[model samples]
Target: MNPHNARIEHHPVLGTLPPRKTIRFRFDEMIYEAKEGETVAAALLANGVRTLRLQEEKGTPRGFYCNIGHCFECRVTVNGKQGTRACLTLVEDMMEVISGKPFSSPLKKGGNHA
Candidate 1:
């Protein structure tokens, strides 16, 4: 994230930004919360979740790099939907999500697969 990307400010000329609302959902056995109007990536980020799916061969941890969903870095399963871009999908309360791969962060840290 960059300051150029988003700024936390409010001015008289600029309308005040509303606070992000929150929702709850389950990914695997874990129950996590998400913000209303926030993408799955944002919600996951808020909940200390940083992995989406593997990058095919050699499984790697891929999270959100581009929030706009063009990069396809945050694809995951949403309630049985496969290859759904987490960055593009907004979270719904009690929604189900699953990464294409499980526990690939270790691989990412190891950098065994690029």
Candidate 2:
């Protein structure tokens, strides 16, 4: 576990969270450990990885602003796919996470979904 991780080690109401199976994954070329069933955002946060992506225009740093999937603040590249929502995507062993400038979006080129 990261020394500066922000994950909830102990909850006031639920007490300590039970240990879960561990998995190894990579984020921006660095390996990180995460619970098998946990979300990519949760795993990144647990490992002190705050900057999930950067603004395309100015390259401003962004991270987990909203825990849910609404904010789009935690968007990242998973494997070779871009615009993957980290908060809703489950972590898998050996998964590759690319953050910041490497992350891309189809909308950036005014592409239409339909």
Instruction: Provide the TM-score for each candidate, comma-separated.
Output: 0.69, 0.82
List lDDT for all candidates, in order.
Answer: 0.74, 0.86
User: How do the residues 1-114 of candidate 1 rate in per-residue lDDT, one tens digit apiece?
Assistant: 322223333668877767766578987668876657877777777667777777765677777888896887888899998889887888898999988774434445556575
Candidate 2 lDDT at 68 equals 89
Best model per TM-score = 2
- Model 2: how far is 29 from its true place, Å? 0.5
Clashing residue pairs in candidate 2 (N, C-alpha, C atoms within 3 angstroms) = none
